[model samples]
Target: MSFDSFLSQIKSKASELKTDVLKFKNKDFLNAAMAGSALIAMADGSVSAEEKQKMLKFIEGNEALSVFSTSDVIKAFSDFIGQLEFDKDIGEAKAYQALGKMKNNVEAARLLIRMIIAIAAADGSFDVTEKKVAQKIAQELGLNPADFEL
Candidate 1:
């Protein structure tokens, strides 16, 4: 192959890889958001509309987050929530498991910790339930819960 042709092929391959990376990153956030919602829902028996709004707003406003459609996010949360609503074990463990998945990615791990803290503080008051769940999550994420001070 000629030099220019080789360079063009390399560039095209790089672009393809970048697009794949972006897609993976987006899917990760979708899963992470599902986990976050699970955590919020389990902190109490029911997930309130106001609470859902707060979480969605936070995700949308995050500088690093992608612009996911409301329906997409709702679907992930709904599926998890639906499972948890009737199934006993799903809700309680979902967020914790998700947090574990992101542990190797330091940035994602830190963000997840911050999110749990934010969710714990969402209702204008942090209670024992939120504190306990958040603490467990912090531990699972290998973060210092005291640093987050939930």
Candidate 2:
């Protein structure tokens, strides 16, 4: 192929790759992230307003998650919280199922565990309950809790 044609082809391929990467930041990943965070937030009995605000701030500040809009993030987080408020067992099961989506990707799983830990400690108190929740999340992600010092 000619030089110009090759360059155009490369650009088109790059665009395709960019679109694929963007797909990873869709509602499925957002829902999983919010569910995991909500589980951790509720570990200590209830999710305080401060904890919610802190989680929202972290989500907004996170580069990987920033691809999504703030309203979408809030809605996902709220939906998970609502599920938990409605039924504990069902909520936890649903959250775990969401988190399971990241189990096959080591890097993503690790990042998720770290995010959960950060959320758990957001209120300045990472208690035993929170740690247990983090550990559970680690397990659900097919990772070792010890890796994150959980």
Candidate 3:
């Protein structure tokens, strides 16, 4: 191959590596975001298509989470949903555990709360059940639900 071609290849590979590294560093945050999304989506005992779309949109738009592919986000969300389906108490516990990881990062926690609220309202009706779940998620992240108008 030409030297320029080789250089281009290397730069492409480096960019891919950088993206991978960013995804790894933000994995915890991704999981936490998905967990919160799942909890709110399932709050009313039914996960709506709009709710799922809202989550994907948020992840695609968010700088920190944009590095992750849609499949990765879906898998994380599915894992939380599967756990909840198998056992509500256990699933909720696991979700809360994931959220608790961000308890100390006040900025991230606040952002998470906002994202959760958006997901809950994605159906165009943020009901009491979803509000309660959002509140619980804020609490898990050591945030104030009222701050997000939950």
Candidate 4:
């Protein structure tokens, strides 16, 4: 009940609130990024270990997405993968729905496209199927595929 103790409690609560606010603000971006990663990872008809590693690295390194913990990113990516595994068509629809959320934010959309491209090429080869998927993602974001040289 001391004044110092009360001040400490308020500070702790404020810090927690800030963290929550940050997570909320970035949730959409995280989902979209993971969605795109899943799409591209599956473009080759399989999700390779290399692709997943690249995605984790990219998200961890990126300033905007670095706020998220590894577990959060992994969960988001796994959710997309699970959807894709259960049903291809439905999974794609949902992934596109997530990407569509960023359609209006050109900067975020561009970053997402870049992230997916990096993931696709992570296995040392960017195949035709992967490029096609990336193109679709770019279009979903209301961006020009050629802009990213897709």
Candidate 5:
């Protein structure tokens, strides 16, 4: 397909996906995932290209979230990072709330929590700020601290 056609196709798919995500009642899970991913990307005060790639890869590969289109995944990450750029506390609060929404599905919740921990540890070492954020995320998931020990 021509580049224009490709772009058009993507836009159409994105619109459809947007509707799907909007219909999702689990805004908290989406928000939490977005917030955690953003925090992981921005833990060092800036988001790196490599970190962004890792987050995209993880979200794309996640089975539980297979319903999310690549564009939606990208959109959520972008939303999270953009929020962080404006205010850290607000971003963290959003992520914390998102995590809180995924408490019922134990496995899904744990998977997200584990992914958040992994993302935080991706850039070599998990800093105090990252750990604290991860802990908060874990609490939102209603998981034990021992599960993702500092």
Candidate 6:
């Protein structure tokens, strides 16, 4: 499917799973989601303007995370990016640690993976770096990369 249609389907599916999404709206979930987004976005060393914009739009529009204020979401994403900019190895370790929090929650982990993939593909090119990062995320989540066709 096209990116727009894929995104639309994700949103619709999220709405259908509102209860599950709501339960995952806690600080840990937000942190993991933001960290995952940052990791995928920075897989190639930098995030494109379009990728950033599309990610923000997806976060804002996603029904599951709509409970958060726009500023809060922005802050979460920025905080992760700031850490990465400061130190690559350390920052990635920290980010992956955050993502590791969702490892036990299969549902949340899957959703997080999908969201990160969407962000990586937002620029219309899911490159090798992004795919590798995503594969690592899948392993961290106790999932298989093949499930996402990575």
Scored by CA lDDT, what does every candidate get?
0.64, 0.79, 0.77, 0.80, 0.70, 0.85
lDDT of 6 by residue, 90-142 (tens): 98999999999999999999888887887677668998988999999999999
lDDT by residue (24-132, candidate 3, tens digit) is 4588888898899888878877656775666667655554455678788879988998798789899999999999998998877877776577556655789888888
Greater-lDDT candidate between 1 and 3 = 3
Off by over 4 Å in 6: 1-11, 17-19, 48-54
Stretches off by above 4 angstroms in model 2 are 1-23, 61-64
Expressed as tens digits, the lDDT of each residue in 1-150 for candidate 4 is 999999998667546533533544588988998899889878867666776677667655544455678788889988998899899899999999999999998877877787678667766889889899999999999999999888
Q: Which prediction has the highest TM-score against the true structure?
A: 6
| lDDT tens readout by residue for model 5, 106-146 | 76676676667755665577788888767766777888867
- The TM-scores, one per candidate, come to 0.66, 0.77, 0.73, 0.74, 0.64, 0.82
Whole-structure CA lDDT of model 5: 0.70
The per-prediction tally of clashing pairs is 0, 0, 0, 0, 2, 0
Cand. 1 Cα-lDDT:
0.64
* Clashing residue pairs for model 2: none
Clashing pairs in 3: none
C-alpha RMSD values across all candidates = 11.6, 9.7, 10.2, 11.4, 9.9, 3.3
Sliding window of 10 residues with minimal summed lDDT for model 2: 13-22
